[model samples]
Target: MPCIGVPCTKSLVRSNKHHLTVSFFQATQKLPSVLLAAYAELDCGGLDLLQGELPQSIANELAATAKAIAAPGKGILAADESTGTIQKRFDSIKLQNDEANRAAYRDLLFSTEGLGQFISGCILFEETLFQKNQDGVLMVDLLKKQGIIPGIKVDKGLETIPRTDDEKATMGLDGLAERCQKYYAAGARFAKWRAVLSIDPSQGKPSDRSIAEVAYGLARYAAICQQNRLVPIVEPEILTDGTHDIATCAQVTEKVLAAVFKQLSDQGVMLEGALLKPNMVTPGSECPTKAKPEEIAFYTIRSLARTVPPALPGITFLSGGQSEEEASANLNAMNKMGPHPWALTFSYGRALQASTLQAWSGNAENKAKAQAALLKRAKANSEAQLGTYAGGAGGGGAAVSLFEKHYVY
Candidate 1:
């Protein structure tokens, strides 16, 4: 007798020297075929000998939240930059990155007028989730008061995977279930885990190990989030840091997404309860050929259609290094070309915040101006989500390139 297939529970039982046993519950569990093959040949006996139960209500809640986050004419505001990353952003504005300053800055963004009209969700760094604003209100509560769902970024960031071509994988899985529980208790209804990959054919970049590491990590994170009653936004962002053409990017994106979905299935994650936040197909940042928004849209949708399952309710595009207007235009183009299976919106950080940060400049006197900046980008992106964006939200730093070479976090 031998064991075969993905493990459904955290516990493993060794019945004898050569036999293993895993409990099986059919009502709310799904075992993916690819994951089965990947974990095949375990020495076990009596696969379904033990009975267990997983709550179906979790699935219902996750699905509901995912849909709300993907509501039409809305997108996400990715204000989840880590403390160190926020330091760089603050430095650009000649501001300090102290806890109070950070809280105030986020308060500015979260308190913007009518943000929930276009932004359905706001992803928070752990610090922001637990911090109190100037008025002593919890930051998470600010988002909820505005009719927005709050999400927490759970991944610790990226680390280089040894024996690979400088490829990276996201860490932060240890105690993730407990952390998810805490985040849920703190008012976070959703969670995000970003996995980074880079393109460099010359260096054999995005190696097999790198792809598997990120895909598997994202799958496990998603499953854990769902188990804790939090909808997971699955983000596998391929960095725009090479000389590859749009076609090359498309090929890599398709391959990466295929592997990711396969792993998601293998982990028995409910597709209906998850959202995808991926990079749009575009020419590499250093490429000589600049792709039109239409071209980017065409390739992006084509690649997604070839791999992403229809069960997913949303596919939120990450801005990556694209400028604010470019991000909006590309999203607009995608919606113009759709009748696609999933809601194609945005989950932008720099593209959504750069101009606003510039406008604010750490001054309370500039609050109104900064908020206007935020609303403009939000409105632009919201319209883009519906293919009705007329364009031109650019001003100040909105059009500046936000790319950093081999960016971390």
Candidate 2:
């Protein structure tokens, strides 16, 4: 049979036959054209999420999860380092990077008294999700006991985009819905997937095709997560290694975000059910121009305003090689500016962990000091999220210059 006046291919007929067995049970609701397009990508990706309609129950539940994760004056603690990545970080402190040491370090972070005061959730590595601390309590239970949501890192890592000089994209979509389901069963209510984009017009990188391809993958991943009951933190991180000025950064960020949202809409992903994990607007690392916190805030908010959907509940800025102080300052400035529709918060990995790592140094006795260091950064960021942070802590943490050209994960 022909479909829509075009001769249906053999693959199309098989897919139609399968749909006959699937569509009878689906609840149908009218969706916008944008969502239909996004669903097209999801369908092509072979995910089994609801196609015609996103159930109101699912949408409402996802909205609540997103809101809770971006709670007022609270943000996420991004401890979702892969085994090897954390090893490199551990090596910096001259500490062993074995699984036990990693567990111990994470335990110290979660065990800190009053950690939930500032952190609303934690994005955990796969191992950390299943691993227990010395006391034999599951890490997810620990986070739950503290009223902190547990989320998993769903993306495997970054891979060089084919035919691109330096642009890259996130992988691990194969069987992602299944991974999200298992993560949800393990007490994770949200998940993160990061897609990296670089700006170097001179190299003709971040080509239009690269942006579209990455955006579609992210949308597909988001759809699958929501179907499996995980609030997807849609991250399209623009790297900061180029010598580009703030204007270039703003331009690139807007373009990338615009593409991302368009794909999400087309994929039928619910905007209210997701959070954005974008790099804060700033001059590139190699740029001579230094933008103040307020300047960065202005550009960041402006870019978001132009591109992001108001339906999204929150935006948790990624540190993206920024110093802990710089990241907090930028977030503070954004909150201080006139009200935005979505919550302005943070989702930092290195920015939140650097000082704590140096202070801990894998010493048992230094645990208190390390926790204090973490609390300090957490408190600073929490206050920043409310626009009340006044620069009390002055660069007292580890000197982690965490900048890589197109970094993976």
Candidate 3:
């Protein structure tokens, strides 16, 4: 009989029981040196946990940092949009996408009065990592002065997968360890790598190939980040595209997460030293039925409870397509329901900045207004983190879902 579609090699199995072993000389004579070297490097991360462990001091620090980022009533501000993406956003408001403009915008956000009360961290793009405010203080220093942790976005961006209509795999794993070391030395203590996936039942989108690719890439990314003393925020966003229902979204999210954890364990990743940035469970953008905040909370928490281990310190949700108020409402609902194992909070991008960006519109005179707008959104998210956000945190584009079809960055 055949097993697993391969002929059962009973003779080889029986031969293995004979305890016959080849000498090093015979082994080397049969296999070339290059082949042996190739076999060894095939597994990039030598996760020999049974033989050794990462330094305890490093582990402790990573865990402490993870906890601090998800501390009570605090959430992360994801201002890490790439240059092209920022250009698109600026275009929306008829602003020039100049370097100085970007610098000023980030400066306004980081220098917001009392922002640290709500935002514990700010994820920055490569450009903002080294930029300074007009006063000449490093942005990283600015954030640190306000008790905010500075994190870097390490992934280059997404690339289309071959043979797929529109599935993407995250790039920038090459030289990641070196980049993490540089970022860490420059005062960043955490990093993010975002991998995007989409759902389209008609086209059979989000194939198993895509999920597996994401899992493998993320695991490698996490290991490299930790080796360089930075906590990794593993963001595998299941995009809210198509016309799928909430149940479909939940199912795909669960499947992706299950594969992610498995890959993490296989690579010997320290669970306590990481944070998961995932999308909240919600209906697709084109779906007719809308889910209430409570329903969204139920499915989101259930999915995490099933796939995420208790060892993880936090699960910060990404507001991919939700409006500012909608995102706050959902986060508040989740916290209300979750005396959950891991801390649940927000790491939002557009949802947190849409109103602020609209308020700024590239005007230097509007800096104070921009800062105020940003602070208001941050406070709302902070309230949501604690399950106390009241009803009104509106944005001008409340009805427009931030769901760009095949959105890059």
Which candidate leads in TM-score?
1
Candidate 3 all-Cα RMSD: 13.3
Candidate 1 regions off by >4 Å?
Answer: 1-54
Q: lDDT tens digits, residues 113-145, model 1? A: 799999999999999999998889999888998
Q: How many Å off is the CA of 274 in candidate 2? A: 0.2
RMSD of each: 12.0, 12.5, 13.3
In model 2, the worst 10-residue window by lDDT is 21-30
List pairs with backbone clashes in candidate 1: 2-44, 3-42, 3-44
Lowest summed lDDT across 10 adjacent residues in model 1 is found at 45-54
Against the true structure, what is each candidate's TM-score? 0.87, 0.86, 0.86
lDDT (10s digit) by residue, model 2, range 91-170: 88898889899999999999989999999999999999999999999999888888999999999887777887856777
lDDT of each: 0.84, 0.82, 0.82
What local lDDT score does residue 366 receive in model 1, on the 0 to 100 scale?
Answer: 98
Q: Which sections of candidate 2 miss by over 4 Å?
A: 1-52, 398-401
Q: lDDT, candidate 3, residue 218?
A: 96
Model 3: ten consecutive residues of lowest lDDT: 13-22
